[model samples]
Target: MSEKTGTFVVTHAESESAVVRDVETAQVHTLASNPGLEVHDVLEATVAPEPPLEVTWEVIDVGDRRSIELVDSDLEPTQHEKDLAADAEVGDLQQEERAGTGEIHVFCVPEDEVEAAATDVLEDEETVARAARLEAVRVEVRRAPDAGVLSVRYLPD
Candidate 1:
């Protein structure tokens, strides 16, 4: 068997296997699960062209931790928002305003909880009403293992 090396973005993950998208070729590859792997983490893998294309991946780098951006807000996050964010396992909440565009950024979120957390934060009664009035509320969540460097962006619509 021959060896191939490439960078891949994990697209799907389960206990036994995962589907990864090759960064250079844009082709999908499957590999035995690396417990450390998470969706959206870019990694380098050594693959053997066996019958099923066996692969082993190592996380050489990590993506940015910032997740969830709230756009076009005039007011600061209320106590309710803070409480919700904290309960959702978010850390380092920062707000920024530039050219009438308001954005809220957060870090240190768990990959598995990104969608649920974002939904809970954005779907709150007050947040829902505010988002509806704005006509466009964008939230992005990036999750990773807190103990290691594996990172994945799980954005909820």
Candidate 2:
């Protein structure tokens, strides 16, 4: 079976199952439901054919998840945060490795430059060489706050 990637809009969700509509093909799919999913949530999944034209999907990620929204809201800059933000020069980058996953978190990138920064980080020869040794999975760029804070998550294979 081949794999198909697309965004699915959740139509109905229950404890064990969910009905979703694919944005690209307009096909409806049913799969095991995930907790906290609700109607209208957009999920990114890779679907593979099962049998008899039936398909099963494994969710790769969720867009606009509530936890992310909550985090964004919580990261709003207060007076102290604004002061700290002002002190740091824009375009500064910081990297830290997660304890167990070996995932790398690159922080403090300006929101306006995240896309370019992510591309540079992923395409750098040094980063490429290191990732080749680590067998990394993928790099994700995220905007953490409305005030232009960005972070990159580098996941390992």
Candidate 3:
């Protein structure tokens, strides 16, 4: 009996069963029971294959479960981030861990589409999940309009 532990996103859920996909491995697992999961819920869990055919899985343990919030940040990008944006080439992306906690993602987009790109990050679940990763509670989108620069900050609390 082997168990896999990772961050999983609930892709589908029903009264009797549910499906989750591992964020890192992209492997899909069908659970033997619903476990009260809901669509888009992110979970830190351990799963093991069910008995018999072992085609389905069971949640052996759950370390954490959370839903992330995405909002347009009123705050402006930091001066240092602005400098990075100015120096980065178009379509360039820079990812760095926050000094304290969480993560920072910086992107250089087309000047005209910076707003649209930011909105996409706000509305796209997968995009937000990819940015937020593990233990992120909220995601903030800060855009430098006309500078073709955008920043997505993932916060732990």
Go through the candidates in order and give each one's C-alpha lDDT. 0.43, 0.51, 0.83
Worst 10 residues of 3 by lDDT: 125-134
- TM-scores, all candidates, are 0.34, 0.34, 0.80
Sequence-dependent TM-score of model 3: 0.80
Worst lDDT run of 10 residues, candidate 1, spans: 146-155
Q: How many residue pairs clash in each candidate?
A: 1, 0, 0
**Order of candidates by TM-score, top first?**
3, 2, 1
Model 2 ranges with Cα > 4 A deviation: 1-89
Clashing residue pairs in candidate 2 are: none
The runs of at least 3 residues in candidate 3 whose Cα sits more than 4 Å from the true structure, single-residue gaps closed, are: 123-134
Candidate 2 — worst ten consecutive residues by lDDT sum?
65-74
User: Candidate 1's residue-wise lDDT over 1-157, tens digit each?
Assistant: 4555665556677877777665566666666555456654555556544345345543323432111233333233344334434544444444333234433344435556544555565444333222222322343333333321111122233
For 1-157, candidate 2 gives per-residue lDDT tens digits of 5556765656677877777666556677676545566654555656555556656544544443311111112233334434444555676555556555544443455667655655565445344323323334344544544455555444453
lDDT of 1 at 48: 49
Local accuracy of candidate 3 as per-residue lDDT tens digits, 39-69 = 7778899999998989999998999888767
Better-scoring candidate (lDDT), 1 or 2:
2
Rank by lDDT (best first): 3, 2, 1
C-alpha RMSD between model 1 and the true structure: 14.6
User: Candidate 1: global Cα-lDDT?
Assistant: 0.43
